[model samples]
Target chain A: MLTGVVPDARYWSYTLYGADDYLIPNQDQRYGYNAATMDYVPRDTLNPEASDQWIDQYQIKISADQQEGNWLPAGNNKALSITLRLYNASPTVYENLATIALPEIIKVN
Target chain B: MKKTLIYFLLFCASALVGRTVAIHYLPDYIYSRFSKMALSRPGAAVNQFSVLMAPDENAKLVVKPNPDFAYATLFYDLTDGPIHILGAMPDSIYWSVALYQENTVNFYVKNDMQYDSDTLNIIISDDAMDQEADIEQIVSPEKTGFVLIRVLVAERDEAHQKAISDYLNALQIP
Candidate 1:
């Protein structure tokens, strides 16, 4: 897992998609939740420190029993796709920061 | 009967092995050769404003502001493997980081919880620090490859914009 930082500017937010180009099943409601089912979860509430009796309070499951927000399935055998949307909210003139290309493959194994 | 069963099992195993070998070897051979050629050869960088692609290191990056033109982007090329982004921006600007797969224009992981707007302002203000954002999930199938970092600069003044551009150009994955 690699990490990067985006500085504070005006207004910015990102949206993620799965291999099928659909919104990954987000247990955390922080990312946009499903408007139809409203079955979204938040990360903070999952932590025990943040919420007392966290485990007792809620039982969560992704498409299957994998990581919390892991959009991909278990096993290193399959391929998945991902996408990113960057929104810049500055009131003035337009500015071009960067354009990123999606990876061709993501292997777990 | 026992001999016949053994023969059948052996046949099945051979067939399975053959299929697996074909499935795995063919794609590997094609991809490896194609990627080698693509990386070894020098080609024009894809994005116009600011883009970086390094096949040996297995990374690609693009930095473009939004169409509205409020902020700038620091996208990565996680085509082959993951890459880390480390840097800072001016004080009065707000920014966010996101992960996307190769060839797609969507985010794989949007860090709204960890580094929300309020959190970003504070973190950038206090001191110059570095953070890690894995792109494994976002760029699946690529397996352990590159990541995109989008940095939005608010000030957008002549000096700030120029600084942002220069900073992006100077980015090194190492």
Candidate 2:
């Protein structure tokens, strides 16, 4: 899992890719969020205004059941890569971007 | 002869146990002492730092970046497992976080998606607060490992940078 804080008038996005570096199938279709109506929704549901605003806080969650192929290889193992981009909507360019990583994994028998 | 061999084996077992105890308990003892020092000393302004730990209540470490910029990281170690991070910035800036293997060179994960951009006169924004990317398939490859935390502060001032650093350092496993 990953989380970040974004200021006003700016936008942030999170995308997920399978171990093979391809877009994962979104059966629920609610994989991203924005500032105006910043909340988790199914991927299939489309927000008309999603293309027009910025998001303040974003959270990304990955579950074990949602994976198609073995992300960690054959031995009950897995690895994943994430790409995050931030865009400044104002004329004044923003400096370096800050990010925090939150690990969300538990082994439950 | 059998008695001599048994004594030797007993001595070796005792030595191994002592070594294991020292390795496991030494850092905790040192960390407590340092934490006490930090609290007793005159409060210095905070600096930029990163906190890494596992979601579990046991493994956690707070890392502060050196203000002098001479060192890339103020602290790091592998006495624990997994990795959790929390950070803060003083100014309005953008940042990205990535996870890499122990090699210190390659990033297994990177996040760089943005919602909008503005030109000289025209402004474009994407209300992406609701955008969700499916990450349920992601997993860590290592059985016992660590995660890296990186922060980028827009302004290079002392106080803001310190806050970022201090916050990261204060993170606890709980």
Off by over 4 Å in 2: A1-109, B1-92, B104-107, B111-138, B144-146
lDDT of 1 by residue, B65-155 (tens): 1321223233233343444333443333333444333323243444333442332221111122354343112223433222344444433
* Interface RMSD, every prediction, one decimal place: 13.2, 15.7
Q: Report every candidate's CA lDDT.
A: 0.35, 0.37
lDDT (tens digit, per residue) of candidate 2 on B1-174: 999999999999999999977777765566455444433435421122234211111212233111111111212232343222322322344433343333333324332232122100111111112322321122343332223344443233457557556544653322
- C-alpha root-mean-square deviation, candidate 1: 18.5
Candidate 2 lands at a TM-score of 0.25
Q: Specify the highest-DockQ model's number.
A: 1
DockQ of each: 0.02, 0.01
RMSD of each: 18.5, 20.9
DockQ for model 2? 0.01
